[model samples]
Target chain A: MLVTKWVHVPEKAINKPRQIEQDGVKFTQSISPWDLPQQFRFLIDAESLTIEWRYLSDSEPVKRKEFPDGFAVELGKTSSRIYKITVSLSALEKSISVMPTDEAEAATSALIKMKNALAEIENYPNENNKVAMTKTAHWWANLPNKAELLANAM
Target chain B: MLRTSLAVYGWLNWVARGYQRASSYIASSCGFFLLIDTEKSEFLSTRPVITKFVQEIQSNMFILFCLFLFLAVIAHILTKKTSLDVWKEIKFILDRYQEKCFPNNKEKDLHRVTLFRLEKHCLFRRHWSSRNWLNFRGHCRLFSNFLVPVLRSGHINGKSNTFFQVGSDQNYEGVAGLAFRQKSQVAVKNLPDLSSPLMAKVKDRKRLITEYALQTNCKRELIEKWVELGKTVPRSIAATPVEVNGQIWGVLVLDSTSPETLSSESVSDYTVVIAVIGKLLERM
Candidate 1:
């Protein structure tokens, strides 16, 4: 049987910037229509991402927009997805995508580090099956124990 | 001997006086001939007339000054000069085109001469019709800079209507219809691949593309093309879609021989112009 260890994992990114069409979202209800700006509320989940727009009443939604597999999310970094939308009357279609600069950059750097760590782990020794038994040292106090374990194993 | 010397000096003075009178008479006569010849021969077209006129003015300032004053007064009285609306420094451009085409109905005279000259060369009609100007209607002629004749000399001076088929967007057929009418002298090229992902991105964006008119809603063909090094001529080719009530009705296309006139910025810069045209077209 394997042994267990205690560690503290840091907080993750749960909320992200909303990505809409570059022209922004517009709604047209009338026959001879003028473009109307839309106000939206976002609800993102594991399976789908949903956006709801209200007309006159606040409690209920007149329009509900849903996407099943467009977005990919990680803890701190951002990924972009394309969304195609069609206006009902005119059949005017548009595609909107997102580009988040700063967090995306940070996430990219973190991903690079994770990849490098994975490469190092792949080249690690075959002797003690060290990685299988180890956990990330999250505090300074845990460093000595982690080092001692490594020393013993070596 | 002193008496003989005096007589010789007197004779020389008479000869000099006669020579001066002859020279003055010749100069005045030459000036008079040119002013009259301007009506008949191509002598006024070759630019040396200005230099000769200046020389005549220098030789006889008072006569030329009176002539200039009289002409200026006549021009002031007769010329219904188009002013830059609401007092601006832009009075000059309209004046140049006006001067080229007007001033004592000189445009009509020039048109007549050109018709006479190109009698054999006039490939199209009997007289040039301002078809583009007609379609645009009313003071929309103020934006007449965009109407381009396909042939370099397809001026209002040329015979009959130019065969370039300078029509409205109602006749925009598939693939080179306009340029073919121009006999490949000019062409507006639009890519057929609307399905490309890049094309979708472009179409989704709001900006106008100069080279690609059929893509966007604006209707101006790019005329200036690439700005060359030397003299700047006004060209007014651009394309913008006429959007009425948030729907694209048609394209407002501008075509001008002068290439500098139309650009993407031409369409972008003149949103009000396009908007006004769109609203007017909607009303139509």
Candidate 2:
């Protein structure tokens, strides 16, 4: 069975510090959240999953990657932004089978609904969609242990 | 107590009588009474010497009362000035918050500005009178399960003045993680137990983890690594969960090298400040 889930990456994960050597002078620079994509679509099958992501501001072609079986796709480090799928490969390899079938399906459905709601808000900026967006943000912010909880559950 | 007071009073009376007799003898020896009229002198002699002594004591008591009153007034003024200064500092912080966080009535980078304002203005800039606390660090960890240092204030290695840094990720450990887990404020005066034996230290560590509801494997080794890297391991730490819309969005943490620099009572201001930041975050 093909299961799909949409993820909204929190801004914290994308904003990371990197050391840059310019003209032999080393300085730490942070990757801005604006420079990274904050949303992704995870396409999961029985043995592998593909992650598709794109920047919000650009009309560029979406980037896609596939991981073998035993790989997991969930929230990124710091419970925030999701930059890529490979970051958590080693950490989540064993937890993929831990999630029950029914719960995984339920979580996928809820995530799909949330993605739709967010899309609606983007398209129509109406009061109802704004309310829905607020609710979604609230729910997302409160799920602090989303990655670990999902890994354990899976 | 009453009997003791009466005894003291009688002793004073005896001393006063002796003083009076000495004064009378001196006056007689000086022959000062020869110049006065006998009748007037007789009247003066009839006056109780104790009355004069009591009068002198009353005058000294009045002088002491005056001094006490002067001190009381000075103390009152000083206290008033201190309170006024605190209020002024709070107002100044609020003003800075408005200017920095919500420039042009909009927040461009909400988290960065919030953490910067708190670190620069509230925690370090306020009347935090401790030299050891001069290196106070303010950091905000935005995730509950895994603490991530999104922004930090104060000096690290005497460089990197900017508040934005992607520091190492931490699990539910230390004061910040404990605060996140507890959903409230958590503060520890001291962190290490270097004086204890190895076995006792292990037991203490376990007890502390259980007591504070922190994750296993105390972050002391990590702190030691930091120390090796020229970073000071905090002696005191306080963390408060930043709640946005009734859900904890993250945690605001402050650490100092001085023990007892932060406590539950001292962190109330921090809580208020974090709460305000949370409300602002909700708007964002």
Candidate 3:
């Protein structure tokens, strides 16, 4: 069975697996092509008709679409499975379709793993922790009830 | 336009006569005409001559002019409306034929629904059928009640040959096949190839020649060379590319049941249809 995930990232960033360490929490981000197997990783920009697909262990991306604009990609009976940590900074939508022959217990275990990973990451603080603090301090300086908060705390 | 408008007006007037009054009026008029016009008219000549000679009161000329106008009005009205009625009947029959050919379409209603996404798509629908398909071009119509489907599916064979089916009929069992090449990608649809195991294969010399000619994009030299070969050996021909919007999409291959089966005019019409289809596919 193949699963599917569509992730939208900043245009400046290349989509790939990455590890980040912040606030005593470890997070990993990754994506697989929606079509074909995981072994065949393709980055398709359909408007320019440019396709870059490569097999595992191959350093060079094979260009296929060739045209300057993008075209629609036909998966031709293949699906994708993706794993990533749930974070506020990035957007992700994932879907999974299991094969008819897949064992129920195996599918459940994979779902559990995904759920645990999401729960762990959701509890972690945002990467830009200083921005929150600076905004709060700036707002407090202009507040009419500023004395009240200090009085209640004291 | 005037004739058409008048015909429509007359029909409206006839229908609005409330059935009761129109029937009685028609019956009474017929009875009066029958009584007066039945006898051999020896008195009619003298009556008309006397009426004609009267200087200030020429009733015969006035009556004759009125009768002429009435006949003209009636003839014009009946002809235009009758043709429209016949055309409506034809459209209904064609729609039914399309429904039967492509039955029970749920999601897209593609067979019936019009897709106005692209100007090219609209142009394709406007020009995609041969004049032979229509039944009323001076009575030279073929397939009076047949629904022709557009080419939407195709297959590329192992030998790099393409076969396609077009027109509403999916099972175009033994029809002329058109083969074209698109950047080395062969797409065959709209017709079944005779050489394929799936269809009825017959040895037709003229058709093969035409197929070769079309594959070569109707080049006169290539066609003449093949014709001079004495029709004994089948020759392999290369397709010349057709350019649209500054790009050479592919070469169009056309074939019919027989070589001279379609006239030059028919071929021209078919070419226009193919060009329209190509533009539609390009947009998609």
| DockQ head-to-head 1 vs 2, winner | 2
lDDT of 3 by residue, A67-99 (tens): 111122221111111211111111112222232
Error of 2 at B67 (Å): 78
Q: Supply the TM-score for candidate 1.
A: 0.20
Candidate 2 Cα deviation (angstroms), residue B130: 36
Model 2: native contacts recovered, as a fraction: 0.00
Q: Per-prediction DockQ scores? A: 0.01, 0.02, 0.02
lDDT (Cα, tens digit) per residue for candidate 3, span B1-284: 32344467657656544443454564555444445532355665568654344422332445644764565465555544443453333333334433433345332122321111111111122221224434222221222212122222111110111222222232111112111111111111222122334323334644654554443233323344434542211122111122233233333322222223222222222222333433443443
lDDT of each: 0.28, 0.40, 0.28
CA shift of B271, model 1, Å: 3.1
Better lDDT candidate (2, 3): 2
lDDT of 3: 0.28
lDDT of 1 by residue, B1-284 (tens): 22234345446545555554465565566567545543344654566766577455556766755765565454443332222111111112223323433234433322121100111122223222224633433222221212222111223422222222223333322112232211111112232222224434644322333333342222333211212222121223333333443333333333433323333332333334434533443443
iRMS of candidate 1, Å:
20.2
Cα deviation in Å at residue B277, candidate 3?
22
| Chain B TM-score, one value per candidate, order as shown | 0.22, 0.38, 0.23
lDDT of 2 at B28: 52
